[model samples]
Target: MSNDAVTPGETRFYQGEGQTQPLFRIEPGINCQFAREQASELMGYAQDLVLDGLLERKHNMIWAAHYLNALAKALLDDAELGLAKAKAL
Candidate 1:
């Protein structure tokens, strides 16, 4: 339930009660172009996997479909924000 955004190039290490230690690192940059490309790639991969029988066409399809949809939505959102920023600039 933490609403804090992770800064680029920052590393976060977590240790908690009854849990093993884990570390996470955030990448640098807000490269929207790369994000869009990645989102496209992920969507294609999900589609291929589903068609190739690697992914189930049932409940698992729903999960993969959700991720693909989410990625596309995120890419669109980022593009809109980038456009807005460019206009402001």
Candidate 2:
């Protein structure tokens, strides 16, 4: 946690990040597809916001999309490994 937010395509546990509940928790289970859908919805919202010229909140939506998709990927990766080493987000 170097005063920087967690970026997409990353799964680093900051010094104090794991002490609190994660903003988004993607479990390695049947809910993965739903997580993907939610990520897509976030992307759509980001796109729509940009189209409407709403610049302020668009980045939030886009960031949500990125991280949600990343979490979904992590979930699937854990499932692929037989869930033995799956972390609970």
Candidate 3:
């Protein structure tokens, strides 16, 4: 029930030259299996957000939905790249 071993010191992805934007943190491992599990979980959550926004017509939800969708895409891309790297090794 601990991830201290796999975890690293810095987890967040920082943007900008000044490091102003702290977008998100990476999942625990660089392995494909971990990537797939994390991606599937994120996709499910993002899809739910989008669906909830569409059904209820909440303006805030819509905004969140967009960001979540983009995050999911980024996560999937990372997962695919991780899978490729893992296969090559």
Candidate 4:
């Protein structure tokens, strides 16, 4: 990992050993760090399922990812509101 944090508008590309194409796009946001972490974890889980050859269980993974995304969004919303509260205090 690089020491520099990813700024908004910048995209990070991943290249796997056997991948001829880009593996994924990573966009970092300072304000939504927690949300980004959660989303990444959820995506990792989904990828594991696919790699394990459990294609039939893909729907479950999708649902899990959806819920995790919602949770992350909620967390980001709270963090944004918390900043206001902190400033007021």
Highest-TM-score candidate: 3
Candidate 3: misplaced stretches above 4 Å? 1-28
Candidate 4 lDDT by residue in tens digits, 1-89: 22222224233333446776643333434444454566567666655655554566556766655544554444445444434444555
Candidate 3: tens digits of C-alpha lDDT, residues 1-89: 12112322134555457887778865645554554566677777777877888899877877776666665555556656555544555
Candidate 1: 10-residue stretch with minimal lDDT: 1-10
Q: Is candidate 2 or candidate 3 better by lDDT?
A: 3
The residue pairs that clash in candidate 3, if any, are: none
Q: Write the per-residue lDDT of candidate 1 for residues 1-89, one digit (tens) a residue.
A: 11222123333334346655544322434455665567688778767756655444466775666556555555545544554554554
By lDDT, the better pick of 1 and 3 is 3
Would you estimate the TM-scores of all the predictions?
0.49, 0.34, 0.57, 0.39
lDDT of 2 by residue, 1-89 (tens): 12121223223222234466445433433343444455566566645655554456556655555554455455444333332223323
lDDT of 2 at 33: 40
Model 2 alpha-carbon drift over 4 Å, by segment: 1-57, 83-89
Off by over 4 Å in 1: 1-29, 52-56
Off by over 4 Å in 4: 1-57
Candidate 1: the clashing residue pairs are: none
Stretch of 10 with least lDDT, candidate 3: 1-10
Number of colliding residue pairs in each model:
0, 0, 0, 0
The total of clashing pairs for model 4 equals 0
